[model samples]
Target: MAFRLRASLERRHLAIDIVSAIVGHVAKADRNFRHELITAFGEAFNNIVIHGYRDRTDGMLDVEAEFSTEQITLRLSDTGHEVDFAGLKPPDLDSLPEGGMGVFMIHALVDEVVYHSGTPNVLSLTKRTAAASENDGH
Candidate 1:
């Protein structure tokens, strides 16, 4: 990672803007900032503002993003409620669920999503570049 950027954002609409800023940093890591990456970032931030804080205005959300020449890792931490990843099943689209797609989309867009819970809850999402994968392929 070149450098880590961390921000304690308010739990509100501006959360989207914060997410966009992170996406910009990911683009800076490599010129190829895919929409798939941005989509995942959006869902991650929405999860923080919505489920993480239970839509309460009293809590703050912290986002940390690391960018390197090959990949970007975004770690989101919140002091709010923690989610049990073991039970974090993808939404059943067959039922046309009105909600719960946010986490699913996040998982789909990123190369990996890991959950950590302690004093502060954490959800880390990572995406590797095509170039990086090409190196692995060899």
Candidate 2:
């Protein structure tokens, strides 16, 4: 009941294809994915490409997506310079900043995001079903 895909950061464009494939598989398990989630997945991929590999070199980006009964988790790992999360601040979206919005977008769109540091920075983005949340309200 587990599926996986991996690729290099050097060919970051391939991330989109992997995302789509994961989305379809996750949808099969839980039939309630919103367009917002789709957009968030795209942003998450971009985050790894930019933040995780923003240097003059080639590296590897490893992504593993897990779908459970109630949620889907995406783990993006990169072998680039370690990210210093201590200095992260929300960008001003009103002024139409050209960059630095991906993390904010991912935070706002996904239900949960967790980062674990090691040789490669690993970020896990989890999304809960709205249907499940609505059921909890009752």
Candidate 3:
């Protein structure tokens, strides 16, 4: 299944809620998987709004979600300032920085993270569902 959402930064919650609802329906039996996916997605969305657009309310976010029986993938695209994803460094866990953990948390929670910087920057996150993990004898 696939779903798409286009929303302004001002009304970001609506987009998040709608996507969360879709995730809930698709991953009903796996609470942990649902939480991880949502959390990772939220972090990515926040980064786009906060860093990519620099908190500009007029900025827009284009989100696409795809689901299979064993995995879920989310792609977020924004026409904001391009990000130097290659230059991003993981947060220092020992120091526990106050506000720079979004990227770190996103990478930790999702199985895959891919970013492409361009006119419309894109960030893609994918994770295997619990069923997939169990099926693989993990």
Candidate 4:
């Protein structure tokens, strides 16, 4: 599935819903997996709007989702400012911090995550299903 969404905070929910539907179809009957995907995608989208576009409503975000029997992949592209992936480190849980947890949560929830910086920066995330892991030896 593919979507071209405006980079606006108000449209975040819509993006999440579309992602949920695609994830559902891929996971078959795994509602829990579906929920997890939604949460991760939601945070990622919010980050794009807040940090990438700086909350500008005129920018556009391109999202493309691909699914297989074992995994789901999401690619988010935007023509906003490029992200400094090197600076995106996992938050320190030893002490309480007020902000900067989105990237951490996204990395934790998904099996693999990647970011490419360019004219249209792209963030690609892949998550393998629990069922797929269980059936690996079969």
Candidate 5:
């Protein structure tokens, strides 16, 4: 299954709600997976709004979701500033920084994170479904 959402940064919650509903429907049997994916999705959206668009509210965000028997993949694209994915590092847990944790949290929650910088920067996240993990004897 696949779903797409396009909305301005100002309407982020609506987009999140739509995506969350679809994710819930597809992964209803696995509450933990749904929660983690939704949290990662929220973090990704927030990054595009806060870092990419600089909270301008006028920038548009494009989100695409693909679900298979084994995994769910999400791609978020924005026309805002390109991200420096190479420079992003996990937050220091001991120091407890106030900001710069969204990317780190997204990395922790998802199985794969890929970033492409171009006219429209794209961040893709993928996570295997719980059933898939069980099938693999994980």
Candidate 6:
């Protein structure tokens, strides 16, 4: 399923809930996978609203979620400022930084993540289900 949302912080929860429900229905056998997917979705949405749009309600966020028998793919695009995807690094665990961990968390939970810095910024995240991994002999 796919939908368009306003790039507003207030709408973050709604977006997360919608994606969670869809993911849950598509991949109901694994609760952990569903949880991780929801977490990644929330982080990506937060980044778009807080950093990309700078809390501007005028910007729009486009989200598309595709679920197959083996995996799920989420594509999010926004018109806000592009994120420096290459510059993102995992937080220093020893220092215990207060912020800048969203990208790290998103990467950790998902199998593949890619960010594009174009006229309309895009973030694509994909995760293979545990069942799929096992079937592939991974």
By TM-score, the best candidate is 6
* True lDDT of residue 127, candidate 4: 81
Per-residue alpha-carbon lDDT of candidate 3 for residues 13-131, written as tens digits (9 for 90 to 100): 77667777777656433777777878888878777777788845677777777877678788888888875544268877799679787777788888888999887888888888767
Comparing candidate 1 with candidate 3, which one achieves the higher TM-score? Answer: 3
Give lDDT tens digits, candidate 2, residues 1-138: 223333334454466555656666553334336455666766765655566566634565667777755567877776666654332688887899997776777777777778777777887877877655676682
Clashing pairs in 4: none
Alpha-carbon lDDT, every model: 0.66, 0.63, 0.74, 0.81, 0.75, 0.84
Q: Which one wins by lDDT: 2 or 6? A: 6
Model 2 TM-score is 0.72
TM-score of each: 0.73, 0.72, 0.81, 0.88, 0.82, 0.90
lDDT value, residue 5 of candidate 2: 36
Better of 1 and 3 by lDDT: 3
Between 2 and 4, whose lDDT is larger? 4
The backbone clash count of each candidate, in order, is 0, 0, 0, 0, 0, 0
Residues forming the 10-long window of minimal summed lDDT in candidate 3: 1-10
- Candidate 2's C-alpha runs over 4 A off are 1-10, 27-34, 84-88, 135-138
lDDT score, residue 137, model 1? 92
lDDT, residue 103, candidate 1 = 76
Give the Å error, residue 77, model 1.
1.0
Report the error of model 2 at residue 66, Å.
1.0
Model 5 Cα lDDT, one tens digit per residue, 1-138: 444444355566787677777676564337778778888888888777777888466677777788765678888888888765443668788997998877788888888899998888988888887677788787
**What tens digits encode model 1's per-residue C-alpha lDDT throughout 37-97?**
6677677766665666775666666667787667778777777677654336888999999
Please tell me which model should have the higher TM-score, number 2 or number 4: 4
RMSD of each: 4.1, 3.7, 2.7, 2.3, 2.7, 1.7
Q: Rank the candidates by lDDT, best first.
A: 6, 4, 5, 3, 1, 2
